[model samples]
Structure formats: C-alpha cells, structure tokens
Target chain A: MHVLRPLYVVLALAVIMLIARSFWVPNDFGTHEQGYTYGWYRQSNVEEWKNFTVKYRGKEFCGTCHAGQAQKLASAHHKDIECENCHGPALFHPADPLKLVLDRSRELCLRCHTSLFYPTSQRSQIKGINPDQHNLGLECTLCHKPHEASKPGRRNR
Target chain B: MNRRDFIKLAMKGTAVVVLAKGLDGIFRPSDVQALATPLRFVFLVDTYKCIGCGFCVKACKLENEIPFDADVSRTWVERYVVTSEGEVFADTPKEARNGFITGQIDLGRGKFKDIPREKIKKAFFVPKLCNQCEKPSCVQVCPVGATYQNADGVVLVDRKWCIGCGYCIMACPYGMRFFHPVHHVADKCNFCYHRINHGLRPACVQACPTGARQIGNIKDHGDPVENIIRTQQVAVHKPEYGTNPQVYYIGLGEEVR
Candidate 1:
C-alpha cells in the first residue's frame, strides 16, 4: 500500500503536467512533416519569413519601363552592373517619388575604379586609377558617358 | 485447449500485429516522398574573383532595410594581406562599402596603421555571410526556440518570439549573428530567404558584377552552382567544428580563417 501510494502521486503529477502543457503551448507548436528534419518550433514562423517583401526588384523590373536605358546599358561596358546600384532602390517608384534620383558623384565611380594594388588577386584585372591623379575633384560622368560605352576615343586607361 | 496454451497463442498474435504496424510506419509512402526531395540550399563564393567593390554590401543594406551608416552588415568583404615574412593581416573598413582604398590594416580598438604594399606577398578579398549550417549552433542554443532552420535549410529567427537573449549570437561559431539595431533581436543572414523564395537572387548576389557570389538548390539536378560544388574542389570555413557549413569557397587562401 505504501509503494502504491508513491505510484499514485506520480500518476497524478503526470496528468496535471499534460493538462498544463495543453493549455500553455500554442496549437501550432509541434513538429510538422514540412520541417521535421529540424526539431519542433513554431511552424508559422517559416511562412512569416517566406512572405517577407523584397525591396530590390532587380534590373528586369527596371527594364519593363525604361526599355531605352536598359537597351543602352545592355550594350555598354557597365552592362553587368544593375541600374538600382546608382539610382537607389525603386520601391514603388513612379507612384511615390515619380523620379529616382541618379548619383553622378565621383565617389560613386571611385568605389570600384580607385586603384589599390592586390597583385595576387583578380581585382588587379579591373582597370583602376589613382583617384588623386585621375581627374581629381570632378564627376566621372562629366567626361564619360556610362551608358554609351561604344563611343570611339572616349575610353580612359 | 488448455488455459496456458491459449495464453501463449494470444501473446504470439499480439507480437505479430505490433511488428506489422511498426513496419508500415517505417515504409510509409508519404514519408519516403518527403525524404526524397528535401530542399538543400548551398552558397558558393569565388574568392579569386571577388574584387571587394562592396556593391554587394551596399545592395544588401538597401534591400534588407539595414541602415547604410550602421557598422554591422549582413554580408561583408574582408581583404587579407599576407606579408612575405609570414605575417597575416586582415581588415574590412566600413564593411568594405567604400572599397579598399588605403593600405591600412585594422588593429582593432579604433587603431589603424598602413601596411606597406612592398611587404605584401599575396592579397585577396573573401566575401562572407552566414554559413546556414546543417546543425546550426544558433538554433540549438536559442533558449526561446525563436531561431530555427526551415525546410529549405535557411536558419531564420522569429523576431517576435525572440527575448533579445544574446546566447545565439555567442553560440554561433562563425560570428555571423548580430543584434538588430531597430528590432533589438538577434539577426543574421537567412540567405535572403524572402528573395530566394520568389525565384530572385539574393541582393548581394544580384549586385555582384563580378559573379563572385552564387547560390543554388543542391537538391535540383542540373543547378550550375551545384554542378560547380560537385565538380570543383571546394572548401568550407572551420571544418573542424563539424557544423556542416553549406557555404563553399573556391580558391580560398591559407591566410583566410
């Protein structure tokens, strides 16, 4: 009878814990077939993360409206670069700001073009110049037409 | 039949039934289907091709809504300079957003000194982001169960549930996690989960003009990135930790940790 009393107490405690867990834990808190490899978590968090909105809409989104600029850019040396890199994010553009401001600053151009010699790496392959010696205090766009890369005798070493 | 014989027969019947039920569970068709096509995402970084232009860093900030002026970044490029004397120096000034202009080496604690270009025997840039390991220590150490790896293998944080406990940030072997300035929760790269789900490249991958960064679904049969990962002799960071990092690097230098 004494041994049986301890067993009865444990049984009662288990029942109480089961009921408490049912009330405290959320309905969606369990392992699902979808993400079963990783153990239990709030499954709805997966959907929340998946549904996050993307701000950078890529160059294809820009090409839809700016076909002329896109076409010109495709044939230029800067073809690989996305238009949004210079113009900033076009989040609901034409509906909000009506115009995306263009950054024609030399600093923008120097971000890639400023020479820092790294002989062992492939970065040396890029045509870089010492910013101080290469037309200091002047916007690169003033002398170079970024979109029109085919222009003869306009290439800078 | 005798009582003992009858009892022995009943026990045999119960054992046979239980074995059959267990076998059915093991070979369930739905379970097999789920296992066959589990999505595994992998990222490849070509260290040789990375020019450290920092466009990726700038683009990631704008895309993810992280403040441009913020010191922390989701992804950043580090420049390594190995001297002829076997000394290694590394720095990521402004998270490589402005690009590497000067030859200064960051010695930490608001101190900087220039490394003479003549002493530099080898130099390269390595772009880094969250490894999104198979066994992410961040997920394991999260006291609130806020950080978890999704079906597609990206480790994500439930910002709402996060208690701002820095356990995860400390647990990460890669030092990838950081405190979100605005949300005050642990934040790290989810491999740009939001964009990748929509068939779009991650902001950093898209902004990389040099094609140094790439990502792909390893489960897919003909993915170019996966093909490269399979065919090439790729290396991962800190393999000794046994975290099973998914990020692969090509032409990784000995100087890179």
Candidate 2:
C-alpha cells in the first residue's frame, strides 16, 4: 500500500502535465516536418512571413502603366537599373498618392557618378565627374536626362 | 487473475503503447519528406564586382520600409583600407547608404581619422547581410520558439510570438539580428522572402548596378548562382564558428573577417 502511494502521485502529476500541455501549446505547434531538428514553432507563422506585402514591384509592374517611359529606359544606358531605384518604391502608386516621387537630388546622381579613384577596381570604368569642378550647385538633371543618359536635355518635369 | 497481476499486465501494455507513439513522432513521414524536390536557396556576393555604389543599401531600405536614418540596416557595405604598414581599417559610414567618398573615415563612437591615399596599399568594399546558416545559432537560442528556419532554409521570426527577449539577437554569431524600433521585435534579413517567392529578385539584388549580389535556388543545378557556388572559389565569414553560412563570397580578401 505504501509503494502504491508514490505511483498514484506520479500518475496524478502526469495527468496534470498532459492537461496543462494541451491548454498551453497551440494546436498548430509542431505541425512541421523535422520538428525535432527545427524547433517546433507554429506552422502558420510561415504563411504569415510569406504573405508580407512587397513594396518595390520591379520594372515589369511599372511597365504595365508607363509603357512609353519603360521602353525609353530599356534602350538607354540606365536600362540595367530598376525604375524604383531612382523614383522610389511605387507602393500602392496611382491609387494612394496618384504619383511616384522621384529623387532628382544632385546627391542621388553623385552616388555613382562621383569619381572614386580606385586604380585596380572596375568602378573606374563608369563615367564619373569631379562633383565640385563639374557643377557645384546645379542639379545633374538640368543637363543630363538620367533615363536617356545619351540624350542631354532639360527634363520636362 | 489476482488484482495485482491484472494491474501489472495493464501497465506493460500502456508502456508499449507510449513507446510506439514516441517512435512514430520520430519517424513519421511529413510533408517535406514526402515532397519530390526540396528547395535550397543560396546567395552569392562578388566582392570584386561590387563598386560600393550603396544603391543596394538604399533600395533595401525603401523596399523593406526601414527608416533611412535608422542606426541599423538589413544590409550594409564595409570599406576595408589595408595600409602599407599592414594595418587593416574597416568602416561603414551611414551604413554605406551614401556611398564611400574620399574623406575622413568615421569609425563609430566619435572616432574619426583619414587614411591617406598614399598610405593605403589596397582598398575594397564587402557587402554583408544575414548568412542564413544551415545550423543557425539564432534558431537554437530562441527560448520562445519564435525564430525558426523554413523548409527552404530561410530563417524567419514570428513577430507575433517573439517576446523581444533578444536571445536570438545575442546568439547570432554573425551579429545580424537587431531590435526593430517600430515592431519591438528581433529583426534580421530574410533574404527578402516576399519578393523571391513571387519569382522576382530581392530588392538589393535588383538594385545592384554592377551585379555584385546574386541569389538562386541551390537545389537547381541549372541556377547560375548555384553554378558559381559549385565551380568558383568562394568563402564565407567565420568558418571557425561552423554555422555553415549559405552566403558565399567571391574575391574575399584576407583582411576581411
């Protein structure tokens, strides 16, 4: 009778633990494959991460509405660059703001155009200018059309 | 049978049932195991080709909605200036969002000094992001089970579940994790999970003017990024830690850690 008392107590504790686990742990917990290796997290969290909204919708998304600008950009030297790189992310554009903001600051242009003298680097191949000597206060867009780099004219905008 | 004998028989049966259940949990064929093909994503960084334009950094900020002025960034470029006297100086001014220019280097904590051009033996830029290790220490140390690696090998954080304990942040050997100011959760790079799954390149990869950053499915032999990983001589940061980082770096300099 004395030995059975400890066994009954252990059985009661096991029942309590089972009930607590059922209430505390989420139903979807440990729902993934290899749960032993990859700590058992709620599987639904994977979908939560996957469903995150993407703000920068690439050039293809832009081409759907602005076909002319897209075509002009494709043939230009800046074709390799995405539209969002210069114009900012088109998050819900043409609906929320009705316009995408363009960063036409001289600093934006100088990021890649400023002459960085690296003798061994391929960066030297890029057409760069001494920002101070070229045009101190004037914006690069005043003379250079970024989308159409070869064509030098004041941007209409 | 006597009452004691009957109880003993029932106990033996229950033990066998519990052992079978435990074995089943260990060996059960889950969805990933049942799949014909599993995806493995890998990233490649060509340090030689990276011109330190900082466009990727800028693009990453805009795409991920990280504040431009924030002290932390998902990706950043480090400039290594190796002096003639064999001293290596590294710095990332403003997280390299405003490209590296010839000026005084702002080593963090109010330390600023200019490394004269003549004294520099070599200089180059190395861009870094979350390595998404095969056996990630961050995932191992998350006490709340909020950080986990997906089947595709991208480690992600459950923002809702994370208690902001910062354990994952500390456990990360690469120092990739950071506390998100707005969300108050531990945030690190997920390789732009939303974009890659939609058949589009990550914002940083697309914004790279010189094609320095590349990502692709390593499981696919046809992938260009995977081909480079297979044939090229590449290296990862801190192989001694044995994190098995998925990000491969080409033209990795000896000066870089």
Candidate 3:
C-alpha cells in the first residue's frame, strides 16, 4: 500500500503533464514548420535565422554603376569573370568608390595564365606561356590588354 | 492489502506504463506533411576541377561569420598526394592559404605523414562539408529536439533549444559537427539554408573559381543536378553507414576517404 501511494502520485503527475503539454505546446509545434520538434524551438530558430550581409556583390552589383565597363565586359571573352576577381572586393564601393584599386601587375595575370604545376587535364588551358621566356621584364598590359586577352592574331571584342 | 491484491495492482500498473509508451507515437507532430513530396537536394563536388585555391573556404568563413581559426572552419579542403611507392600524404593547411601543397601532416594520430613530391603518383584536392543526411544520426540522437531536418531535407540545429550536450557531435559519422567555439553549441553546415531559401547559392559554391562545387534540386527534371547524376557516376562518402548523405562526389578516387 505504501509503495502504491508513490506510484499513484507519479501517475497523477504524468496525467497532469500530458494535459498541460497539449495546452502549452504550440499548434504548429512538432508540425512541418518545426520539423516535428519542440514547438517553441521552431519559433526560436526562425527568429535566429537572418539574412547574412552580402560581402562579394558579384559582377551584377558592379555593373550597376560602371555601365560602360559592364557593356565592354559583356562582349569580351572575360564576360563571365567577376569584376572583384581581379580588381579585389569592393565592399565599400559606393561610399568610397576610390577604394577599387586597379591591379595592373604581371603577377596578377600569372596567377591564372601561368603554367601551373597541376596536370594539363585539370588546370584551365589559356595559351600557357612560360613567364620568364615570353615577356622577360615587360608588363603583361604592355602587349596584352587586361579586359580582353584574346589568342594571337585574334580580333579583340 | 493482501499479497495477491498487491500483485494484481502491480500488473495493472505495468500494463498502463506499456500503453503510455505506445501513445507517444500517436502524439508525434503532424507536420510530417512538410516532407510529403520526394524532395531531393544534391551537392556535387568534382575532385578533378578543384585547384586547391581555398577561395571557397575564405568565402564560407566571411559569409557565416566564422572566426579566423584553422580548427573552427565550417568547410575545409584536403589535399591528397600519392607516391610512386603507394604512400599517401593528406593535409589541410590553414584555409589552404598557400594552397594544399604546403602543409605538415600531424593530426596527433599521424594518419599520413608528409612525403616529398619527387616520387609522386597523383595529387588531388577534396573539399568537405556537412552531408545534410536524409536519416541524420544527429537528429535521431538529439534528446532536446534541437537538431532537425526540414521538409526540403536540410538538417539544421536549433541553437536556442540546444543543451550543449555534444550528442550530435558524436552521432555524426562524417565528423562535420563541431561544438561552435563562440556559441558553445553543436554546429554544422546546413547547405547555407538561409541563402538557399532565398534563391542564392551557398557562399562556398558562389566563391568557387573553377566551378567545382555544384548544388541543385534533383526533383526537378530540368535541373542540371538531375542531368549530372544521370550522366556522371556520383558517390557518397561511407554509404555503408546508411545515413543517406545528400552530398555526392564526382571523380572520387579510391584513395579518398
């Protein structure tokens, strides 16, 4: 009888909790919106998820201001390439448009055009040239244009 | 009460307890309607196309607000170089900064020591992220219902509900789950759920220079992922575990884990 008394109390507590849960649990809780988890958790996760502030605003963002450059890039072989890829990230462009520095260095071009150590099948084949043999000391921009580095004897777009 | 009467009462109590256990299934959340359709999300990583540039790692870190710590990265690139003698050296440098070629191999267990490249066989870069499994072990083990999978099959952790018990971290077979250094809660990749829900690619995919990483819904026949899966031989990591990982690999060699 003594053991049964505690069992009865436990049963009563269990029944009360079950009833309270039905009332306390949100209607949408454990539903599809919450993925059948705790109801309050769904609400919390939704509120926590916020749009991340975009840092690299692709070519589309750059094209908004520099329409002429955007138009030129569209017709060139480098049309698909992003402006920030070469010019560097312009996070504060509109506020400080001067921040977009022009990288006319030969190393910048070699980063992609150089004969990389990677296998021929893997690395992109753009006329692979040994930097030491071709230009020696001359700048890449001196002979090849930055925007459209077309093949030899090909007409620039 | 008499001994016989007490036994009868105990039997009745046991029966009620058994019935109560069965009732939980009846009370399961009806929101399973969210998964009514066979929604499929495919993440394809082309090992051949990756150049080990680590731009994707940089982009993911910036976009996700992850601190600049080598150990706390959400996504990382591993470079595997095989030797002529069949020796394999695998290493992941600090964000693959100077590329995958320049890193020492000391992961405590000394899995693969650094070997000089003169006797090289073949080298490749493998990028890794959370699998977003269909039957996520993390979701099944979460006692507080913190980890869950959405209707579209993206596994996510409810940060607020997480009890920091570290069960999900241990449950994940891919070793993708990590206790967030700052938040002190279990965190892993959700395929950029915040961005994908808004029709944007994940930061890593967007930042990839070689178009090595591709993600799309396989449910839509018109989607490129569906065509790729049909045309190319796609594979998931550790299929024997039966986690049903959504991430697929293209050009995955036998050497890769």
What is the C-alpha local distance difference test score of each model?
Answer: 0.83, 0.83, 0.70
lDDT of 1 by residue, B1-257 (tens): 99999999999999999998877655443354555645789999999889888889988887887778989888899999888899898999888877776556777899987767788888899999999998788888877778887767788888878899899999888889999999899999888898898899999999988899999988887999999998999999998898999999998887887
- What is the DockQ (computed on Cα atoms) for candidate 1? 0.40
- For model 2, the stretches where C-alpha displacement exceeds 4 angstroms are A1-21, A151-157, B1-37, B101-103
Interface RMSD computed for candidate 2 is what? 2.7
lDDT of 1 at B253: 87
Cα lDDT tens digits, model 2, B85-181, are 9988888989899877544567789898777768877777899999999888998888877888877889988988899999988888888899998
Supply the TM-score of chain A against the true chain A for every candidate structure. Answer: 0.75, 0.79, 0.59
DockQ of each: 0.40, 0.33, 0.22
Q: Per-residue alpha-carbon lDDT of model 3 for A1-157, expressed as tens digits?
A: 7979989999999999999989975554454443333222454465456354555667787889988888877776666456765675566677855677666766555644554344412643444456668667777777676566434324343
Candidate ordering by lDDT (highest first): 1, 2, 3
Name the lDDT of candidate 3: 0.70
lDDT at A151 for candidate 1? 48
RMSD to native for every prediction?
Answer: 5.7, 6.6, 6.9
What's the i-RMS of each model?
Answer: 3.5, 2.7, 4.2
Writing each residue's lDDT as its tens digit, candidate 1 over A1-157 gives 7879989999999999999989987788765443433445787888888788777788899999999999999998889889988888787887865888898887777667767678877887777777778878878877788887564327543
Instruction: In model 3, state the lDDT of residue B191.
Output: 79
DockQ of 3: 0.22
Prediction-by-prediction clash tally: 0, 0, 3
